[model samples]
Target: MANSANALPETGFLRLPQIVGNPHANPPIPAIVPVCRSAWWLGVREGRYPKPVKLGPRTTAWRIEDIRALIASL
Candidate 1:
């Protein structure tokens, strides 16, 4: 909850806020990767981050496994 996505389950997908966080929300979700949204997307576009899964026309998410692997690599 502090600096990493270890709080996540062993298998699943995570939305953008659940990954980069939403500090202004009711409960103030902590960041898993600790990067701004734009930077995150840039990383994605540049192939420095994991590809996302489109769950809906407007919903994009990344696999928990991919995030875990990204954290490990970092």
Candidate 2:
């Protein structure tokens, strides 16, 4: 999972396992993309990073808020 903007390393915060682990606790990119693709086709998928929302022209991003909330709910 892509780290939240608040969790970026350039923010000068400690790189602890717990915090980083929070996002990766789900799965890495290798496992996530396949499901994300399927979810994109199914319309029931959620929590995909870097492809959250569709911007105009040619852009996309995973709504960080959605992924975080989904994680929290889980």
Candidate 3:
């Protein structure tokens, strides 16, 4: 699926890799915010980005609406 902000579903969650960009792609695509992983984490820590929800011991994601809001703010 297309990972652009406009292509995200209205209600769901997005993992860090998806939020950053799918690294598995043949040629890496830019993330919505196009920042490095460390920067993204820093944003989360500093409250500049949405906090993630822990879905499982090895799973965490952010709400889609929260991502949309962040995009809009930018």
Top of the candidates by lDDT: 1
Candidate 1 error regions (>4 Å) = 1-3
Tens-place lDDT digits, model 3, residues 10-69 = 899988877888667878755777787899999999999999999999999999999999
Better of 2 and 3 by lDDT: 3
- TM-scores, in order shown? 0.91, 0.36, 0.84
Q: After superposing candidate 2, which stretches have Cα over 4 Å from the reference?
A: 1-36, 44-52
Identify the candidate with maximal TM-score: 1
Instruction: Tell me the whole-model lDDT of each prediction, alpha carbons only.
Output: 0.89, 0.38, 0.85
Against the true structure, candidate 3 reaches a TM-score of 0.84
Quote the positional error of residue 34 for candidate 2 in Å.
7.6
Error of 1 at 22 (Å): 0.7
What are the per-residue Cα lDDT tens digits for candidate 1 across 19-51?
998999999988888899999999999999999
Worst 10 residues of 2 by lDDT: 11-20
Q: Local error of candidate 3 at 36, Å?
A: 1.1
